[model samples]
Target chain A: MKETITLKIKDLFEDIGNQATFVGSFFRNIFRNGFEWNELIRQCYLIGLKSLNIVLITGFVLGFVLTLQSLPTLQQFGAEGYVPNMVSISIFREIGPVITSLICAGKIASGIGAELGSMKVTEQIDAMDVSGANPIQYLVVTRILACTFMVPLLVLFADAVSLLGGYVGTSTAGGMTAALYFSKSFSSLVFSDFFPAFIKSIFFGFTIGFVGCYKGFKANKGTESVGIAANSAVVAASVWIIILDAVAVQLTSIFVYNQ
Target chain B: MENVIEIENLKKSFNGSEVLKGISLTVKKGENLVVLGKSGQGKSVTIQCVVGMIEPDEGSIKVLNKEINELDEQELKDIRGRIGFLFQHAALYDSMTVRENLAFPLKRVLKVKDEAEIEQRSVEALEAVGLADAIDKMPSDLSGGQRKRMGLARTLIVKPEIILYDEPTTGLDTITSKEISRLILSIREKYKASSIIITHDMSCARITADRIVIMNDGKCIAEGTYEQLENSSDTFINSFFKI
Candidate 1:
C-alpha cells in the first residue's frame, strides 16, 4: 500500500512536469517567425464570440439570484440599502471571475482537448512535423493566445451583464431606480475589487489553455484516448480554476487587506 | 550526390527495448530502394531516421551530404522541406479541403506568397495524381486509394529531391495497391527523385523498387533485384517469397 501511494505521487508530479514543459514549448515557439494569424482569428471567433450569449445568460442569472437570495436575509436586519454594495463586492471579487472561468473551462477546454487529441491519434501532427510545418506554432500557440486574450474579455462582458441583472433584481421590491442602484454599486467598489478579479481571470485563462493543450497533445495513443483527453481537460481545468482563484484571493488578502 | 541518403550502423531503442540494431543502408540518386520486412520489424523506423523523425541513438544519417543530427533547427526544416514523407494513413488534414491540404506545404515550407502560383501548383499536383475532382472535397470524402494519391500529390507539390514512403499501399485492395505502386513508379521517374519505400506489400515492391533490401531482426539481411531476391537460397528470405 505504501509503495502504491509513492508511485501515484510520483506519477502526479511527472504529469505536472510534462505540462510545464509543454507550456515552455508554447513560449519557445512564439518567437519563431511564422505566426498563424488566420487560425488565431478563427479561434478567437470560436472561443470568444460564440461563447458570448451563454456567458451573458449565465452571468445575469447568477447575479439576479444572488441579489434575491441576499435581499430577505439583509432586510431582516434593516440593511436593505447595503444590497447593492453586497452584490457589487460579491460579483466583482469572487462570483464573476470564478463562475465565468468555470464556464469557459467546461466549454473551450473540452473543445480544444478533443480537437487536438483526435489530431494526435490520426498522425496529422506527425505529418505536420515531418512536412516542415510547425504544429506547435500553428495549433498550440495560436489557440493558447486566443484563449488567454479572449477569456479575460469574456469575463468583463459577463460582469457587465451580471451587474445589470443585479440592478434589475434590486428594482423588484419597487423602491429603487436604475441610477440609484448603479450608483450605490459603484460607490462601494474600489480598484482592489476589480484588479484582483482581473488578475485571477488572466491566470484562469492561462490554466484553461495550458491544461487543454497539454492533455490533448500528450494523450495516450488510441482512439479512446481522444474521449479521455476531452473529459480530463474539463475536469483538470475546472479544478485548476478554483485552485488558482483561492491562491489569488490569498495573495490579495495577504498583501492588500493586511496593509 | 551519388548517395542521396546514407545510414551507418543506426540503432534505436524505446523504453529499454531495442527496435533497430546497428542497421545500415544506402539509396542512390534517382534510385527506388524498397525495404521488405515483417510487420513488427524496424523498416519504418529506419526511414523515419533518414527524415530525422526518430533519433538513432548509436549512429549517423546523412541526407544530401549533410548529417541529419548535425543540422540546426532551421537546417532540419530546410532538409525536411527538400524531402517528402508519405505516412501510411496519407494523413490529409481532415479539416482542410483537398486543395488547401495540397497548398499547405507550399505556403509554409516554400513560403510562396503568390496565390495564383499556389493554386496552379496545387491544381497541377492534383492532376498528377488524377485527383483534380477531389480538389474541393474534404479528406473524409476521399476513398483510401484517393487519399493515398492525394498524399503523394501533396508530397510532389514540393518537388522533393528524395521521398520516404511508409507502407503506401497497405490497406488497399490488390488492384488499387498495384495502381498506387505504378503511380509511385511514374512519379519517381517524372520527378527524378530518389526514394526509400517501406512495405510488406510484395506487389508494391515488385512494381516500385529499383533495388530491394530485406530487413529482419533489425538488420538488413539481404539485398538484390526483386528477381534475384526471389531466387535466393536462404530459407528465411525464401519464406517471404514463397507463394
Candidate 2:
C-alpha cells in the first residue's frame, strides 16, 4: 500500500510536469510561422456556435432557479425590490463564470480530448509529424487559443441570457418591470465585480484548454485510451475550474472588495 | 552505389527491453531495400529512426549525408521535409478531403502560395497513384487499398528523394497488396528515389526489392536478392519462404 501510494504520487508529479511542458510548447509554437487560420476559424465556430444552445438553456434555468429560491426567503425582511440587485450581482460576479466554465468543461473539453485522442490513436499525429508539418502549430495552438477566446465570449453571452431569465423569474415571482429590473442589476454591479469575473472566466477557459489538450495529446496508444482521455479531460477540467474559481474569488476579495 | 541512409549501431529500448539492438544497415541511392522481419523485430523502429521519428538510445543515423542527432530543430525539420513516410495504416488526416490532405504539407511545410500550383501538384500526385477521382472524397469514404494508394499519393506530393514505407500493405488483401507493391516499384522508377520498404509481406518483397535484409533478434540476420534468400541453405531463413 505504501509503495502503491508512492507510485501514484510520482505519476501525479510526472503528469503535472508533462502538462507544464505542453503549455510551454503551445506558447512557443503559437508564434511560429504558418498559423492554421482556417482551422482556428473552424474551431471557433465549433466551440462558440455549437456550444450556444447548452450555454443558453443552462444559464437561463440556473438564473430562474436562483431567483425563485432567493425570493421568499428575502420576502421575510421585505427586501423584494433588492432581488434583482442580489441576483444580478451573484450572476455577473461568480455564478456566470463558474457555471458556464463547468458546462464548457463538460462539452468543449471532452470534444477536444476525444477528437485529438482518436487522431493520436489513428497515427494521424505521427503522419503530420513525419510529413514535416507543424502538428503543434496546426493542432494544439489553434485549439488552446480557440478555447481561451471562445469560452469567455460564451460566458458573456450566457450572462446576458441569464439576466433575461432573472427578469422573467422575478416578475413572475412577485412583480417587476424589465427596465427597473435591468437598472437595478447594473446599479448593484461595479467595475470590480465585472472585471474579476471576466478574468476568472478567462482563466477557466485556459484551464479547460490546458487540461483537454494535455489529456488528448498524451493519450495512450489504444481506442479504449481515447475514451479514457476524453472522460478524464472533462473530470480534470471540472476540478480545475472549481479550484480556479476559489482562487479567483479569494484574490478578488483581497484586491477589489477590500479596496 | 552511393549510400542515401546509413545506420550505425542503432539501438533503442522501451521499458528496459531492447527493441533494436545495434542495428546497422544502409540503403543506396535509387535502390529499393526491403527489411523483412516478423512482428516485434524492430524493422519499423529502424526506418522510424532514419526519419528521426524515434531517437536511438545509442548510435547514429545519417540520411542524405547529414547526421540526424546532430541537426538542430529547424535543420531536423528541413531534413524531414525532404522525406516521405507512409504509415502502416495509411494514416490519412480524416478531417481533410483527399485533395486537402495532399495540399496540407505542401502549403504548410513547403509554403506553397500559388493555389493553382497546389491544385495541379495535388491532382498530379493523385494521378500518379490512380486516385485522382477520389480527390474530394474523405479518407473514411475510401476502401483499404484506396486509402493506402491515397497515402502514397500524399507522400509523393512533396517530391521526396527518399521514401519510407512502413508496412504499406499490411492489412490489405493479396491482390491489393500486389498492386501497392507494383505502385512502390513504379514510384521508385519514375522518381529515381531511394526507398526503405519495411514489411513482412513476402510478395511485396518479391515485387519491389532490389535487395532484402531479413531481421531477427533486433539485428540484420541475412541479406541477399529474393531468389538467393529463397534458396538459402540456412533452415531458419528458408523457413520464412515456406508457404
Candidate 3:
C-alpha cells in the first residue's frame, strides 16, 4: 500500500513537471521566428468555423431555458419586466462564457487531442521531428494560438446568439417586443460584467488548448491511447474551465464588482 | 570511402530496462549497412538515437562527423536535414495529399519557397519512386506498399546525405518487400545516399546490404558480408541463414 501510494504521488509530480515543461516549450516556440501564420489561419478556420453551429445551438438553448426557468420565480414577485435583464446578465457575465468554453472543451479540445494523438501513434509527428522541422512550432504553437484567438470570438458569438434566443423566448411568452427585449438586455450589462467574463473566456481557451495538446503530444504508443487522449483532454479541459471560472468569479467580484 | 555515421558504446534504457546495451556500429558513404535483429532487440532504438530522436544514456552517435548528442536544437535540426529517417509505418502525414506529403520536407527543411521548384522536386521525387500518379491522393487512400514508396519519395525529396530506414519493409507481401529492397538499392545508386536499414527480413538483407550486422540482447553479435555470416558454423548465426 505504501509503495503504491508512493508511485502514485511520483506519477502525479511527473505529470505536473511534464505540463510545466510543455508550457515552457509553448512559450519559447510561440515567440520564435518563422511563426506558422498559414497553419494558424487554417486552425482558426477549423476550430472557430467548424464549431460555430454547435456553439450557437447550445448558447441559444441555455438562454432560452434560463429565461423560461427564471420566469415563474420573477412572475411570483411581480417582476416580469426584469426577465430580459436577468437573462442577459446571466448569459453575458457567467453563463455565456462558461457554457461556451465547456462546449469548446468538448468539441475543439477533443478534436485536437485525437488528431495529435493519431499523428503521434502513426509516427507522423516523429517524422516531422526527424525531418528537420520544428514539430512544436509547426503543430503545437499554431493549434494553441488558434484556440486562444478563436475561443473568445466563439464566446462572443455565443453570447450574441444567446441574447437572440432570450429575445425569442420572451416573445413566445408574449412578454416584450423584440426591440424592447434587446434594449433591456444590453442595458443591464456593464463594462465590469462583460470584461471579466471575456478575459475568463480567454483563460478557458488557453487551458483547453494547453491541456488537449499536452495530453495528445505525450500520449503513449498505442491505438487505444488516441481515445484515451481525446477523453482525458475533454475531462481535463472541462475541469480546468470550471476551476478557472470559479477563480475568475472570485477575482471579478473582489476587484471589478466591489469597486 | 568515408564514415557518415559512427555509433560507439551507445546505451539506452526505458524504465530501468536496458534496451540498447552499448551498441557500436558504423555506416560508410554510399553504402547500405543493414542491422539485422528480431523484434524488441533495440534495432529501431539504435537508428532513432542516430537521428537524435531519442537521446542516448551513454557513448556517442556521430552522423557526418558531428556528434548527435552534443548539438543544440538548431544544430540538431541542421544534422537532421542532412539525415533522412523513414519510419516503420512510412509516417506519411495523414492530413496531407501525396503531393503535399512529398513537398513537406522540401518546403520546411529545405526552405524552398519557390512554388515551381517545390512542384518540380515533388514530381521528380514521386516519379523516382513510381508514385507520380498518386500525387493528389491522401495517404489513407494508398496501399501499404504505395505508402512505403511515398515515404521514400518524401525522404528523398530533401536530398539528404544519410538515410536511416527503420524497417523499410515491415508489413508488406513478399513481392512488395523485394520491390522495396530493390528500390533501396536503386536509391543508393541514384542518390549516393549512405543508409542504415534496420530489418529482420533476410531477403531484404541479401538484396540491399553491402555489410550486415546481426544484433541480439542489445549488442551486435556478428558483423560481416551476407555470405560470410551465412557460412558461419555457429548455431545462433546459422539459424538466421537456415531454411
Candidate 4:
C-alpha cells in the first residue's frame, strides 16, 4: 500500500510536468511561422457558437433561483428593493463566469478530448507529423486559443441573460419596473467586480483547453483510451476551474476589494 | 543503381523486448523493395525508423544520404517532406473531404498558396488513383479500397522522392489487393520514387517487389529476388514460399 501510494504521487507529479511542457509547446507553436488561421476560426465557431445555448439557459435559471431564494430573507429585513443589486453582483462577480466555465468544461473539453483521442488512435496525427505538418500548431494551439477567446465572451453573454432572469424573478412577487431593476442592477456593480471575474473566466477557459488538449494529445493507442481521455479531460478541467476560481477570489479580495 | 535508403545493423526495443535486432537493409532508387514478415517481426518498425518516426537503439539509417538519427528537428522535417508514408489503415484525415485531404500536405508542406493550382493538383492526384469522383466525400464515406486509393492520392500529391507503405493491402479483398499492388508498380514507373513496402501478403510481394527482404525474430533472415527465394532449397525460406 505504501509503495502504491508513492507511485501514484509520482505519476501525479509526472503528469503535471508533462502538462507544463505541453503548454510551453503551445506558446512556442503560436509564434511559429505558418500559424493555422483557418483552423483557429473554425474551432472558435465550433466551441463558441455550439456552446451558446447551454450557457444562456443555465445562466438564466441560476439567476432566477438565486433571486427566488434570496427574496424572503431580504423581505425579513425589508430590503426587498436590494434584490436586483445582490443578484447582479453575485452573477457578475462569481456565479455567471464559474457556472458557464464549468458547463464549457463539461461540453467543450470532452468534445476536444474525444476528437483528438480518436485521431491519435487512428494514426492521423502520425500522418500529419510525417507529412511535415505541425500537429501542435494546427491542432492544440488553435483549440486552446479558441477556448481562451470564446469563454470570456460566453460569460459576458451569460451575465446579460442572468440579469434578464433576475428581472423575471423580481416580477414573480410585487416588483419594480424593468427600468428600475436595470438601474438597481448596475448601481452597485463597480468596475472591480466585473474586471476580476472576466479575467478569471479567461484563466478558466485556458485551463479547460490546456487539460483537454494535453490529455488527448498524449492518449495511448487504443479505443479505450479515447473514452478515458474524454472523461479525464472533464474531470481535470473542472477541478482546475474550481481551484482557479478560489485563487482568483482570494487575489481579488486582497488587491481590488480591499482598496 | 544508387541507394535511396541504407540501414546498417538497425536495432530497436520496446519495454525491454527488442523489436528490431541489428536489421540491415537497403532500397535502390526507383526500386520497389518489399519487407515481408508476419506481425510483430518489426517490419513496420524498420521503415518507421527510416522515416525518423521511431529511433533505433543502434545502427545508422541514411535516407537520401542524410543520417536520420543525427538530423535536427528542422532537418528531420526536411527529410520527412521528401518521403510519403501510407499507413496500414490508410490514415485519412476524417475531418476533411477527399480533395481537402490531398490539398492538405500540398498546402502545409509544399506551401502551395495558389488556390487554382491546389485544386488542379488535388484533382490530378485523385484521378491518378481513380478516385476523382470521391473528391467531395468524407473519408468515413469511402469504402476500404477507396480509402486506400485516397490515401495513395494524398501521398502522391506532395511528389515525394521516396514512399514507404506499411501493410497497404492488409484488410482488403483479393481483387482490391491485386489492384493496389498494380497501382504500387505503376506509381513507381510514373513517379520514379523508390519504395519500402512492409507486408505479409505473398501475392502483393510477388506482384510489386523488385527485391524482397524476409524478417523474423526482429532480424532480416533472407534477402533475394522473388524467384530466387521461391526456388531456394533452404527449408525455412522455402516454407515462406510454400505459403
On residues A149-179, what C-alpha lDDT tens digit does candidate 4 reach at each position? 9999999999999999999999987788999
All predictions: root-mean-square deviation over Cα? Answer: 1.8, 1.0, 1.0, 1.1
Write candidate 1's Cα lDDT for A1-259 as tens digits. 9999999999999988887788888999988887989989988999999988889999999878888899999899999888899999999999998999999999999999998999999888888899999999998998899889888988988888888888888888764788888999999999999998998898898888888888889876799999999999999999999888888888999997874
lDDT of 2 by residue, A187-244 (tens): 9989988899998898899888888888898897999989998999999999999988
Q: What is the CAPRI rating of model 1's predicted complex?
A: medium
Residue B167 alpha-carbon offset, candidate 2, angstroms: 0.8
lDDT of 2 by residue, B152-206 (tens): 9999999999999999899899999999999999999898889999998999999
lDDT of each: 0.90, 0.91, 0.92, 0.94
Candidate 3 lDDT, B1-243, residue by residue in tens: 789999999999999999999999999989999998888999999999998889999989989999999999999999999988888999999998998888778888888899999999999999999888999999999999999999999999999899999999999999999999999999999999999999988999999999999999999999999999999998898899987
TM-score of 1: 0.96
Model 4: lDDT of residue B129: 92
Q: Which stretches of candidate 2 lie over 4 Å from their true place?
A: none
Q: What share of the true interface contacts does candidate 4 keep?
A: 0.81
Rank ordering of all candidates by DockQ, starting from the highest: 3, 4, 2, 1
What's the best-to-worst order under lDDT? 4, 3, 2, 1
State the RMSD for candidate 2: 1.0
- Please report the TM-score between candidate 4 and the true structure: 0.98
Best by lDDT: 4
The residue pairs found clashing in candidate 4 are none
Q: What is the DockQ of each candidate?
A: 0.79, 0.84, 0.92, 0.89
- TM-score of each predicted structure versus truth: 0.96, 0.98, 0.99, 0.98
